[model samples]
Target: MRILLTSALAMTLAAMAWHAQAADPERGRSLAGQCRTCHGLNGIAKIPIAPHLAGENRIYIETQLKAFRSGKRQHEMMSVIAKDLSDEEISHLAAWYESIEITATMPE
Candidate 1:
């Protein structure tokens, strides 16, 4: 029927839009070049003070980045860096870091 066809069309459009907006880890990896001095290419911190970002939850990373961008969380360096990031960029960075797989082991 016409109604069924219209509903299917609407659902297809919405799905395409969602897919277009999805985060891209490859783009995030490219963007992460800026973060490499402190955080390594793999999201592990190169500096003692910088926390490791590898395997961190995507939402948690997004939240912290947004907070830094908004000045709610104060980090002298992070504030300066995050201020220039767009929402898309934040999502990409989070995606890149979150995509990394890490395993933990207890010392025998």
Candidate 2:
């Protein structure tokens, strides 16, 4: 019984740690203010050069951001901006953008 209890405690602690490391949308929203010039707060692109970010897959966004930060993906502006972001910040930003809902319609 003691071993079972210890295992349960360990699992509980691991779950808590996982929750603590989870992405935070509110923090992402706050951090995303700097991105508003090109990518609107709603994740829609404000300028022709920027792609819309709203509803993009979190994994995809995270991958791209990391690539930019690592210099594997080269975009002068994005690389500069991503260079300062921590992994957690990238996760949060991806979460926030992923949370937005977007619909596409066929253009006539």
RMSD in Å for all candidates: 5.2, 5.3
Could you tally the backbone clashes for each prediction? 0, 0
**Deviation from native of the Cα of residue 84 in model 1, angstroms:** 0.4
lDDT of 1 by residue, 35-88 (tens): 999999899999999999999988799999999999999999999999999989
**Per-residue lDDT over 1-108 for candidate 2, one digit per residue giving the tens place of the 0 to 100 score:** 999999999999997578446988778899889888899988999999999999998879999999999999999899999999998999889888988999889999
TM-score of 1: 0.80
What value does the lDDT take at residue 13 in candidate 2?
95
At residue 68, give the lDDT of candidate 2.
99
The lDDT values for all models are: 0.93, 0.91
Best by TM-score: 1
Candidate 1, overall lDDT? 0.93
Q: Supply candidate 1's per-residue lDDT for 61.
A: 93
